[model samples]
Target: MKITLLTVGKTEDAYLKDGIEKYVKRLKHYTKLELIDMPELKNTKALTQEQQKSKEAELIMKKVQPLDFLVLLDEKGAELTSTQFAAYIDKRQIGSTSHIIFVVGGPYGFDASVYQRANDKLSLSRMTFSHQMVRLFFVEQLYRAYTILKGEPYHHS
Candidate 1:
């Protein structure tokens, strides 16, 4: 299955960018992966948080296709262990899923429409992290999940 990670704004820190790139390179051998960083909304000084989310939702939806399985990386979503997340990825592959889009919404989180369209939601942690930080964390977890699936030494219980 192809996995697409769609997030808002660019990852600025050199360390974070390097870390994410490292895992993404390793992931190339495992599956098709795409990283889409939608440009941050410009001139938002006048827009309300809800309005920002609404505009961000439009961009998020545009990347998603009708057949793609949308998974929102939401704080309130189901939390899974590394091994469990590996199984989740395995299950998707076995189920013949062609495309799975995992979205990291804007700072205020997803709008009602984005939530409505999601097929599933997953929480990386109960604690909140900056959206930029989330990008690195999610990619690393995804890489770990693959290694777990292959019984590699990269992950230990």
Candidate 2:
């Protein structure tokens, strides 16, 4: 299955960008992965949290195709171990799924519309991380998941 990681805003830190690139490069061997950075909204001083999320929702919806399996990287979502995640990825590859789009939303999190559209929700940890950091962590975990799936030594139980 082809995987797409669609996130809000560009990864600014040089180190973080490099880290994401490293795993993304390794991931090419396992599956096709696409990285999309949605532009951050400007002039947010006047908008309420809900309003910001609502506006962001509009942008998010535009990128989503009717057939894409959407997954949100949310704080309240199910948390899985690396091995379990591997199984999760493997399950999709075994199924008729063609595209899996994982979204990392902006600071206030996803709006109701985005939630309603999502097929699944996954949490990297119980603790919250920045949107930028989540991108890196998610990609690395994705790489780890693929490695685990391949029975590679990169991940150890």
Give candidate 1 regions above 4 Å deviation: none
Q: lDDT (CA) for every model shown? A: 0.95, 0.94
Candidate 2 local lDDT, 2-58, one digit each (tens):
999999999999999999999999999999999999999999999999999999999
Clashing pairs in 2: none
Q: For each predicted model, how many residue pairs clash, with residues at least 3 apart or on different chains?
A: 0, 0
Residue 67 in candidate 1, Cα distance off native in Å: 0.4
Q: Which consecutive 10 residues in model 1 have the weakest lDDT in total? A: 130-139
The TM-scores, one per candidate, come to: 0.98, 0.98
Model 2 root-mean-square deviation? 0.7
- Which candidate wins on lDDT? 1
Q: In the order shown, what is each candidate's alpha-carbon RMSD?
A: 0.7, 0.7
